[model samples]
Target: MTELTGTSTGQPPTVDLGPYADALTHNPHPVYARLLEKSPIHRATQPDGTETWLILGHPEAKEALSNPSALSSDPANATPQWRARYLGDPNARELPQGKSMINADSPDHARLRKPVQRAFTPRRINALRGTVEEHADQLLQGLPSDAAFDVIDDFVAPLTLGMICTILAIPDLDRDRVRGWADRIGFPTSAEDVTAARHELIPYTDQLIADQRIHPGQGLLSELIEATDDGQMTPTELRATIFLLLNAGHETVISLLASTVFCLLSHPDQFAALRDSPTLADQAIDEALRFQPPAISAPPRFAREDCTIGSTTIPGDGSLVTVVLSSANRDPREFTHPHSFDITRPPGELLSFSHGVHFCLGWSLARLEAGIALPALLNRFPDLAPAAELSALKWRSGPIVRRLEHVPCKSGARSSAAPPHNN
Candidate 1:
């Protein structure tokens, strides 16, 4: 067993991330590196007061994530205090939006995932290539030829929003409402805010499902509705599925597109390299996902049985455990020059989309968007650059997701550096 770091009070070693705001916002690799060196596992208390065991090492995280028999995603397996603190309600058994594949264990997860999986087949996703390109082109055309604009709000978000909406067949008018709910839930400052945003989103999702039943559309939702009718899924599961798609569907892609642009711009040499060789766009996207993942950690998994990660044994009786993807992806043992943003590096083990059965379903879609959006923007503008110093740009302060609030950039002749816009 590794010698645990100790505190003066003689309690177990604990890491509170709240104190490291600046490091987390600007760059969190150094802090994570120090923690990984000490031990792969550490005890920590979340801002909401939920105690959790964090898996930091690359191998340790893989072991924990792959062992479904030992680690469960159901909150029912979580400690009472963890459940109470995490949900902000002592009586709450599930998240405000209810159970979905991302938080389900075993048979339930498999059943829920099957139908959605069938709907997102390669053919289905690949067919959307035309739509993705069209959206990117339309957004790029609107950019001022020689001025600063937010890559996030003006381009990435709308393109992602359009893609997800088109896939789910969400109406044009309702698209903004869905985006608004996703924004609030994705970057929530408190458990209460998440709860409120989810509560608002649920009814909206339910209504969409209801509408689909009456007038079947050509989108994935209509297919999922059929699955429900065939006894493949329950009504509650249908609602939960749509809710998950709407929320996670676009948000992850937004993070991917925006973060890739920001990372390349920050490393001018790499940006130039990518421009010189357009085929490297795919490699660049993968590197961006590794260097600055959209998500900070996977949903907390509870110990269903006594499980040993590295030298630490997590109790069998419902203990909260979180796999820190950001840390694991940067573990020095896992990659060469783990902290540097090198787009040409060969892809290997990456936890950015997580591992095991819960790996992100929309990963391919996100890559496709980036493949189209990045090259399209660059090819058109050919001289797009950051308008503000990378440090001057801001990231939303949140626990689960690390997304830029906005990415200000200059196009054409406006590539000169300037102060950050207040937006």
Candidate 2:
């Protein structure tokens, strides 16, 4: 284990985050809290030898993101040597294409995100109300009230995938394919698997875009492809759009849902309180989001131009700065009782979904899924409880998405609603 050499004061010892990797995967709050007290930005070395400036303070993280000039989202700044040093050897799939919306800054990101943004606009997403709710109900339909269930495997993952599938009107997508892509993308053990999945998905999305082009559907993919405007998305961009929608669509929501349920199931009072006060779901989700963010931190960002975070000025184009959201959510400067999960919180303090121009575009959809699925799940399994030992359950590992491998649970009270799959 990495030694905790300093107290909640002084220049904390430069800690190696690897030993705590297990705790980080399952529950990172303790480590996050510890890091926040001493310094918001700490130098950390990974087992892979990559170094990062981990920004845990809320203000610092926001600054790091908002100051695009100082920090670039471009992966191009990452030298081929560095890229190979990290994800290149994962040996799972090939490394993600070097430049996507996530990697590009300014004109590129704006160009890429613009047309697709129209489809995700509040009104457009609001129009999806019925489809979203129907899928929520459908997911609830097959869940067995008295059986043991893995929420990640059987529920959350399916709900997110189905929602994205609907958005793309992908009629023939096998759930297995979606799951495999997720596993490959999220857990990049080897570069081969990562590259293979990334490339494979392009063709998969290409085929969907082609079908949508011929027979446009009521879904967003077709809408984005055929969007009428001066700033239209090219076929390549359309493919990227679908890829982003599919990959980003469900993964975090699944994490948020499963994490929230775990929190509620463990804390019975909160569960009962939520049941009694339906309005609390909004805050409950926010608190859960802050407390157990699905993605602890985003990839290291580089400077496109000169920028500063506090007193430190970053040079133009290639300075690496990471916004460690996990730490930020617990930053004492912004949150009170940051260690505890309280549903009744003032919203602005949390940055789990991020903030500013790069704020997650899928925020509305992710929240809606959680807002619907959780209440429905609880209503069905009123007496649901963890079926497996907390210490025994596995937490999925990655620098990208963090979640449980399985949330095995014994279903409680029978739901009057149709089983999740039946719907």
Candidate 3:
């Protein structure tokens, strides 16, 4: 509760995200560390006059998140602007609040997550390991031999976009559109860009939802649809759940995988060290998530009753809790040497996914994807180095995360990182 070095009470911060978007597109560490230590819970004012509490401290973040009474992830009474634009209109009977798994409570959450869980079982993921590797290989093969390429475009983006299509049974989805939507959503250009992507994606998803019902197959969406027809969930419930699956499960992996690779490439010795011990790649993924988590902030939370997070007392019912996820990932109260990227760092301390029932359900999927991709990439291009001016590289300055705009690197480029790989 001590005042960190340079924080001064000024205007409350809004989720305008122009700066955050830029930082993410560039590098956001120094800013995030500053915010976390000094202002664990800074006051922010949004353009809509909506005030937000930015929980930047790691311990404070975990406390705020686990406090069920204080943070409500549901959008039942969300701002009209958010409801209409993101969740769809309720009064208009278009996209109602109770239509999805995300907006559901405990019993509902269990019910919705249960069936989806069955489809995304560990066995299912393990089975896809080879396919995932092949997918990575294909993307790598497409890159010009011994040429500089944008890692985001040439590899990470396609693997994720294609993977999502595989999960949804959308065999013929416009790969370009899928990649575009996921990228824009992950590191949006502006607020308008975020809004417009949503508007476009909704109809596209709606159409897909319709097709899944009629011509269902062996994908997550199709499986959910099968569950719905079996009276496991209502049709309306099915569409929203599918939407959540697509939206939540898509770009997060891309951002995480892309960000982790960018981290490795930035620190060539570290990259080479890991290449020498490839299994460390998984731990590196965890470390990268802790060191530079993609989901920069928590989903919106409104107090259901009253609560106290640490010494600060938050008033009842109307309070909006903003979980600074990156802060928690680096909270000294939680991790040993919060800033250092220790791949073998104990998992119990990291909250990059989260810490409760509301924790990321797709965490396994994210880990699996990163585990397969990271080592495989380095194993393939051990001598890789940035072809672009990494010093000139920037992060998108948004509340969401720290992510690179693009990672342009020279494949097979000689480096002092490590000995050339078998590839």
Candidate 4:
């Protein structure tokens, strides 16, 4: 175990988070709070033994995310040792060609994101309201009204997966296989397993794009293919973009839905508040995002040059850097009663969707889905509550995203007009 040093004041010592990895995976709030009391910028050692910096303060995270000149998103900007240990050596591993917008900076990020932005416009996302509602209604209708069921498997996962698949125009027959590959790639048992999954997915993505090329459909993939023809994006870029969309598009929303439900069920007052006033759905979503963001940290950014987030100066020699989104969202300096889960809490500087150039592209769509689903679920089952103990609920272990494995929920007779039972 790494030595724990430093206090809430003065220059804090560099702490290794390796020991708290499990606890952080299960319940990160307490650990994050303890760290925040020490320093906004803390030096940390990665599992691979590489030194890194974690930015935990709201203002500091925003600054680090906003300044791409000092911190580069491209893996190429990483030091050779850090890259080799984490991502493997360039020569040894043949990485997929082209860069997804998430990994690109400046002009490239802008260019890649612009074409997709049109597809996610207010009008476009709003048009999916019917689809979102329809899916939520259909899924809820299928659930046993008075029995324990996995909210994730029976409702949330399918709702989100369907929306993303519909957007990508993936064939109904291939959706399950695609989702399986995506889950494997996103949450692998080991580096080797993730590598195998990526290898399998890359060829499938190439073929998917090729099919879109020959037989254009109404999907975004076809539009992206057209964009490729206009020289806005390349063949490899199209494949990478599709892969990113398929995985990130659904996975984050799943996390959002699960986390939101967990938060609400754990706090019956808030859940009842949302149940009583459906209009607070949006506010509830915002509060849930702030209280427990889907992604714990943004993807690691490399230091292009020496950068100082607070008093801590990150070295210029391609040091790895991560902006802790969950930490920043809960920063006392940013919000009143940062630890409290209040749906009525006004929206503020929440870093859930992140900031600056690398902001999530499908944020509108995500909000649209959650805004509809949350209210619908509560209305359909007014007496909904978690079947299992909230404290003992398990979360998936990973570095970037925080996800619940399952949300075993029990509900009463379906009745939209019924008042929630006080327990």
Top candidate when judged by lDDT against the true structure: 1
Better of 2 and 4 by lDDT: 4
Winning model by TM-score: 1
Global Cα lDDT for candidate 2: 0.72
Across 1-423, the per-residue lDDT of candidate 4 in tens digits comes to 357666565545668777776767787787777888877888776544567788999999999999998999877788887656556574332145458788887788888888888899899999999999999999999999768998888899899999998998888888888889878877777877776787789888898888877888987888898898999987887787888898889888888988888878767778778777888889988998998788989988989898777778787888889899999999999999888889999779889999998888889999999988888888877788777767767888554777888989887532233222210
Q: With candidate 2 superimposed using the best TM-score fit, by how many Å does residue 409's alpha carbon deviate from the native?
A: 1.9
Q: Report the lDDT tens digits of candidate 3 across residue range 169-225.
A: 765547677656655765566657776775677677778878777886767887787
Q: Every model's Cα RMSD, please? A: 3.2, 5.7, 5.0, 4.1
Q: Where does model 3 exceed 4 Å of error?
A: 1-27, 46-50, 79-98, 184-193, 344-348, 397-402, 412-423
Model 1, range 269-374, lDDT digits (tens) per residue?
7888988898998999999899889988887899979988888888887888989898998888899888888999978799999999998888888888888998
C-alpha lDDT of candidate 3 relative to the true structure: 0.68
- lDDT, residue 113, candidate 2: 76
* Global CA lDDT computed for model 1: 0.83
Scanning candidate 2 in windows of ten residues, the lowest lDDT window is 414-423
TM-score of each: 0.93, 0.88, 0.84, 0.93
The per-model lDDT (C-alpha) reads 0.83, 0.72, 0.68, 0.82
**What are the clashing pairs of model 1?**
none
Which is the winner by TM-score between candidate 3 and candidate 4? 4
Regions of model 4 farther than 4 Å from truth: 1-12, 90-97, 413-423
Tens-place lDDT per residue, model 2, 1-423, is: 457445464533556887776666666777767876766776666545565667778888888888765576766665455556555542322235334466667887887777667777889888888877787787678778667878887888877888788777877446679768867887777767776888787777778777777898767776687653344655565666677677778888888998888767655667678888878988898888987788888756866576656655545635456788878888878888777767777775668888777888888888888888887787777677787655566777675678777888776542233211100
Worst 10 residues of 4 by lDDT: 414-423
Ranking by TM-score: 1, 4, 2, 3
